[model samples]
Target chain A: MKRAAAILGIGTDHVYEVDPDESGRVSAEKMEEKILYCQELGFSVFFVGITAGTTVYGAFDPIEDIAIICRKYKIWLHVDGAWGGSALLSPKTKHLLQGIDKADSFTWNPHKLMSIHLQCSAILIRHTNILMQANQMCAGYLFQPDKHYETSLDTGDKTIQCGRHIDILKLWLGWKARGHQGYAEHIETLLEKANFFYEIISKREPCFRMVIKPPFINVCFWYVPPSLQNIDQTSLEYNERLDKIAPRIKERMMTNGTMMVGYQRLDHHPNFFRAIISNPATTKDDIIAMIDEIHELGHDL
Target chain B: MKRAAAILGIGTDHVYEVDPDESGRVSAEKMEEKILYCQELGFSVFFVGITAGTTVYGAFDPIEDIAIICRKYKIWLHVDGAWGGSALLSPKTKHLLQGIDKADSFTWNPHKLMSIHLQCSAILIRHTNILMQANQMCAGYLFQPDKHYETSLDTGDKTIQCGRHIDILKLWLGWKARGHQGYAEHIETLLEKANFFYEIISKREPCFRMVIKPPFINVCFWYVPPSLQNIDQTSLEYNERLDKIAPRIKERMMTNGTMMVGYQRLDHHPNFFRAIISNPATTKDDIIAMIDEIHELGHDL
Candidate 1:
């Protein structure tokens, strides 16, 4: 979203919760807030960065009729699917990105979730000549009349950088090596693992309070340590204590080099340990071990 | 001029030399004619691509200053020195590019003559904050609001391309390897070669014509073939014959593989061959061979 906004010179975006609200569909409320904010600020452009958790907080469009309101207002809508966009391939989840076709631009990162190496992101425009219009430099040596056809959009020109690395070679090879079915199956396995963790952790004795139980792969949970037994804890205070605890736990986990997890504050909460399992190398045993280690780390506290 | 105008979202620039009086420098008279033409056509910008023999046309400053003299002019002067800007290294030749400092933006390619690699070109602004202001994007993964440097410029963001290749690495390494003194010496050798070529080619014969020979590297000349004895023909008709002879002669020379030379029509004048000697591998003998090949090629014409 930042790269696209910088390149095209317009728009602001807000992160969307991947899961649905109480209604069993992705809530458009956060998007609505951002849109209203853009309106308040008099901006004509809006972008949405959508990722995991669609089942809990965000479902796709409930009615196709919202397209009518958007067209009436004339806001240039863009979808930033740098990671979760790969889910577009799955029949079960494609509906979650329902009104996406109405967007003016879509930025998808093949590098992130798609097993491709770093830096294979593309911002595809829907309408006419845009990238070229934004970044054409008639460099005499680089773009001479004699050899114009050989110039493959000079992708360097449209980009916000000069002399960009050629990431297409890796993507082209990946497509040739692993067909769509293989990638879909990989995604399915990850989803299954995510769901398995949710089931186990929810039932465990020293339970994790899931700020988001994660419809997809991102799982956020706080450890209710024994040291906080006497304190009347609000969600904010517990989160603050978790913030103090999360880093030391995460660092200790990293020293082993066997299991890895993500830890960060999402929304208003402070540091809770979030397991974002993008690496397929992880197994159920590793997850159990991590949870056990977290419990051990928090027991004395 | 074209690439940058395109980068800045301007359209095609009709590339035509305003050298009516046939002086190498753009004279005040030519400037007057160009200004009149631009105004007649209702142009808001003037891009100046500086070159040698530019004195005959008039120095860029007086011409640009007079263009600035035109009222209500939003003329954004851009100086494109993808070749000759290296003159800044020398005190003497530096005067040639005097008012270039006043340009809104200047583009100079180190790759062309400064012995840098393919993409080591730069567009320098006196104060470059405007460029950052123009290309800012609010990307989460890239530009974050965390406790790092915020206002400081990352060279990456200022570019139009993302996932940038480190083209500057070679230039930086070269600068470090061969300090400024080494580069200046290389430039001095280039000056010597330019003077050498100017001396040699000018001495060739009446059959040869020197169009623009400066102290710098570019030396353009026309090969006027003698028709068996003394037959004068139109330069256009003469060049049409020479064109057919030159390439066939060049093919045989290339087959020998001792050398190669680039020949092209300059400024719509079919009367000349442009001999650009920026390559460090070139020598006095190579210049001699180039002249010999053209002369030998002319005999058959």
Candidate 2:
């Protein structure tokens, strides 16, 4: 609905990029080329999805590219960092999102990685109240003078939600509990864990490949059975048939109470499993247990 | 943000009501007229806010006025029963929410009175998948063919939110701990306490009004100054100014640690105090104490 609204709201719009993976990661060259492609296409607005890294037109560029591209093309750059964005607090991952301050408007989900509960998302526009200007209800009931929220910065009045859930308290409490440095340490720890998983899994036989490498959390791995091995016929049927297998395995694994792995057909690959590690409770032992469970259950099938 | 989304995405809205004075009651006739006025204004959607009171518009209607008007106009009806919706389980109060079943959607907040943690708000739609139809973001990585959430329901995908917080456990636990009739009993007890206050306060002051009268958990009262004789312009300003005066008293009350009374402006009068009796710790003694405190402090002013 929001997407359709955006499209309809603007007479003609072009998307610079959208991450198909939803993995909260994008590639460097994908970013650079997308900017260049938009410039070539003579598109004035470049809406970039920077929530998570799932793009690989290959290589990752710092956010400075946004300034560079906009300055070059005289285009408006909008960053949709809707998720995995609260990592901005971490000293370790803050470097990962360098030069984001240059973007015209950026959305960061405090609700996601910041652990502030759902709807705790914040969209900081370098230009203030841009969304308010874009979307207006013009109802006097919303702005009628009041004593409680006397300043009229009800926040709800300026937001997309009517009677928004007060997710701020959760953020406020969480921030109070874990100071800025504490939150940074938390993200740093998660990054270290993500890197650990990438190191352990990427080199394994039949592990296939990861989407966009070590630093990213969602490590995508494909399993090539010995029977289907070495035959590189990329038939549509071969792709569709292999797609049917992973869910069956996932279904049985969940029911059997051993382990459950997320599977989907990403691009050309018939079927693949994606292990998204975000839970803080997850340990190295759990990782080893998960891999062993996957192998033991998947090897025979 | 939800409010803005409703107004922008859904189109046109109004917030015609807020909690009334300490009485926690509003006139049923006034409510009916407001709903009718909304009809006159060509509102296609009726989002009823039925947290407290004998909300009889949609639920009951000897004339079936709201429904008849809605059916005539093909209006979409929704009820926001968030704060006090659990009253649906109470035999005494369920009549207040008569035609709720006819609503397209209903929002119930368990966190309000059920001791459930925050963020446990549920939007129950008559037709399922409307939320998903409204907010699904398709991607290559997360949502795809042969995925765990495909052809089968995984409750999580139906939300605009991702990495959804686990709000069900607290509710499920409440249901288990306080079985079927137990919750209803809780509501009944609370209502009984409300009635107790209403009965005593009415007996205490002959000139005192219940706003919407008895059988309501909330009691709106006015202390007719020894000088007042009529509900004229002076009385309105008197009420409004008096409402502001409570806060000055409240700050001292907070420091004194004796009791607390919330004051706010209402449509019928200027502004007045509103007391929410949901606090189980409250008793008839506390009510009397609060009154005494008000009189002691307010008499001079």
Candidate 3:
């Protein structure tokens, strides 16, 4: 969130972003009209955040209409849910985190879609000592408020980190070997392989197109290159030959070691292919061999 | 550093602090007389930092006389050197970080003295693209300015982190299985077991005392028990009975699971025992069995 409002010093002219609706979510009525136009320019609106998933359009923002305008301006809301919070272990996508139990803070990143390995994340909060009153240092050589056991159970002085690594033991051993019904059948099989690759690349037209069909597992697309497939799809030479075909089919899928994805230019979209169905062991023949290896390496890009 | 000046918002009333000297370093003439008295109250002194080691007085700070008053006030020096930058891999404690290569950032953790395991730290800096102009985020779906390799070698757009963890392969396999003269003989055998536990607790003063002789591996002391060794040391009932004998000998060395050391009350030095030798497998008979286990777990507090 602009690096947590630039580490809370909060500057970019007191940061007030808002805009996101054509399905890349967040427009809770333009975030209540930009918090009533930054409280009519007097400005005190402290917190809102809201993005339930959204890194390259795994979009989920409404959050019960931004928690009813952050509980009518008592502000603080937060959410984030890092990568759709593994759709809250999917009771069929947990109502896309409805109001996230009226979030006072959420964050959740069980390392994106609960695969868990790389730096699993958390945050959570809700209330209790407010993260020990916003991170208590208490550092008299490591939190010794005369420690004979319960020095408030030394959470290392409620951390801004003075040595922290056990990062929740592989997210508590991947939630104890995937319990909650094996993480809701691995988040309903990665949302059914992102709705089966957005229903076969929106029924394969002009060699694949759909950029907005992905509501969660970030499918985004754009293979297109039968030599720009009869150009002029709102051409500027058909988006400069579809922005040089996803970095030349991602440099031939990293020099043909196999398929890869992630391309870019987001809003007013140009370079596409995001494909982030967070690996619940991928197969449907690896999403049809990533669309037949991006149409056999961009079909003569 | 007051949490990087409260994450750069910089306000504990624009943080002043200077003091340290009674052997707990940092008084380059009271830090250039508090940066010429905060520039005669017009205060524009950006950075100074300096430490070199100092987490509980393993003090070093005179970094070549604070790098000549941060180059005569063109400020920005920084040094920290988390635990004496492992005394620069010990060429006899590399002149306690001399001018630390005229520092413009240093940090260095090597997991405190190069044992390098839990989150091995780094920082270093000295100029090049200033950590990509203080952290870049050219995030158009992850820095793809037409990426066919060399999208400015995308270091995830110079990191605030969008998925990070390859935490330097166990500090590069413990510096490739201890090269560099086997990490200077494991940092000169943990500075010779902290000068052999500060020469047997300063030759066992009236049952041990030496709190300030340590300049590096942080020995610090006090154990004085035998029912407070005929008191009257500098009475306030002898520093409140030597501050309740190092937290009752650190709560009987954590209920007798052998020894640990970190006690606190620094400035007026009350609860003493800091110890911190950063384990080079301790043994000088585990520093004389940690002074016969802190005089047998503090002989009658």
Candidate 4:
């Protein structure tokens, strides 16, 4: 999105980022405030990007309220559902993306949650004609007028590229094999496993600290060693020390080759492990093993 | 290249095109003239794109002289060797890309002449650091400071994309299976086959009017029917009628489902067939069969 803004010659000052709530979800009020702030600065609110599932905590923004603001401002609402879009298949979790139908455009990657290999992403737009209007080059040599079949089916002109990879076949076949119900069940099972992890970490108490109640599959947490158990959580020195634990534990995890989990610092927070449960194959054993491995590696720290 | 220029905010007037010579190759003099014209218009010559193998006639530009002009103007020389880069593997055809080492950057597609698969292309740059310098976002969450092993190997920062397809594995494995010698022989064989087609088409005289002596694998020709056998080649009406022949014949070919060949119109020229011989599996019989099929399908036209 930054790249697109840069390409369009939008300056850094014009690009505003609204901070998310403590739960890592962006409120509609914050979005409206940012829009009004831009309007006050004499900038038109052309595009409003809402993260359907954020990277760190897998938090879903309040799309319904955000949609109302976007409609009022006449802005093109784009949803980045790259990680969390698969949850929409589940009947129980479909409410997470309640106002998704109101979005002007949405980007989803089947490769992530669907496990259909890498580079299988799709950008769906409300108006199909807009794609051709924006991208059609009408290169006479390739896309000729006189062809055997319906020329509209020839997708070459609608794309920016001359040649594209056949990344759709695997996803098509996978979807056919799994069916809609199978996919929903798969997503539901993963979320349930994430909930299990959240419960287990909460019961562990001082040994582990749950960052937030994850709304989706990404569970953010930190491993607290016995040495740091007595330290005040609000202390600057404590967070500085806590920041060192994850990277050290990650280093040991790499060397030991037991399990791998991603760690990152998100806005004033210390480095914490972001455990993703998108893989349907992941069992309770794998989740338990990850925790035990992190404790075993960093308990002395 | 045009798309890149557009993204960089260069207008169509600033983008100049130097026509190829009678032999279908762009000369150094023409390039220098274009560069001088751009300078006179107060435009900086930042990039000089030299086509290694043109689409219509498979012509190779005089790169050695073009490189010298680029050096004098302090312009970055980029060679579009998408079609002809595989010729580098062949000892006999390597002379076609004589001054390739002098180019600042080059685009090569292993999917084309090398016949690996679709969408396997590479952008080769002389300077390694330039890519990272231009593209690095410094996204702390994704590219962390503390990681195991060499962080320099993480190519995500060097690319504009967050997630990229693993396109190198197939190319690597294919290259390993077929060593340098095998690839050289493969390219040599294809070129030899193209030469055989050129010779046959030349011998066939009035039936097949050869466009130009192809420098590479593309053999451009017109399959003249018996109806227009006696007409003047320079007549406007004759060329107009000739233009209709290819599309008509192409329609017949598709309906018959015998073989497929590409046809296109160049500057002031009628639509002529461009028989590409990139397929190593193509035998002399296939070439002979294609001509026979064209004759059989297009005789009435």
Query: Among these predicted structures, which one has the highest lDDT?
Result: 4
Worst 10 residues of 1 chain B by lDDT: B52-61
Tens digits of lDDT, candidate 2, B152-235: 365544564555667777899988998869888877777777777677667766334445464445555554443332545355
Candidate achieving the largest TM-score: 4
Candidate 3, residue A89: Cα displacement in angstroms equals 33
Off by over 4 Å in 4: A7-14, B8-13
- Please say which candidate is ahead in TM-score: 2 or 3: 2
Give lDDT tens digits, candidate 1, residues A1-301.
3444434333324332334344334345545655666668775534444432232222234323344345556756555566566767666566656667776776677876677876588777887667766665544323333331455645656665555446778888987787777777767777777787777778763546566656456566777677665555565666567666666665656675545555555456656666666667779997787778787766666
Docking class of 1: incorrect
TM-score per candidate, chains pooled: 0.60, 0.76, 0.36, 0.97
Fnat scores for every prediction: 0.11, 0.25, 0.79, 0.46
Q: Write candidate 4's Cα lDDT for A1-301 as tens digits.
A: 6655654456445568899989878899999999999899898889999888887889999888999999999999999899888778899898999899999998899999888889899888997688777666676766677676788988887876778888899899999999999999998898899999999999898899999998898899999999999999999989999999999999988888877788999888999999987787888998888788889999999
Off by over 4 Å in 2: A1-49, A52-62, A67-83, A86-92, A104-193, A233-245, A279-289, B5-64, B113-115, B137-140, B144-151, B204-210, B223-240, B255-257
Instruction: Give the CAPRI class of candidate 3.
Output: acceptable
List lDDT for all candidates, in order.
Answer: 0.59, 0.59, 0.81, 0.87
In order, the B-chain TM-scores come to: 0.80, 0.76, 0.35, 0.97
- Supply the global lDDT for candidate 1: 0.59
Scored against the true structure, residue A259 in model 3 reaches a CA lDDT of 63
* Rank list by lDDT: 4, 3, 1, 2
List, for all models, the DockQ compared with the true complex.
Answer: 0.13, 0.20, 0.28, 0.56
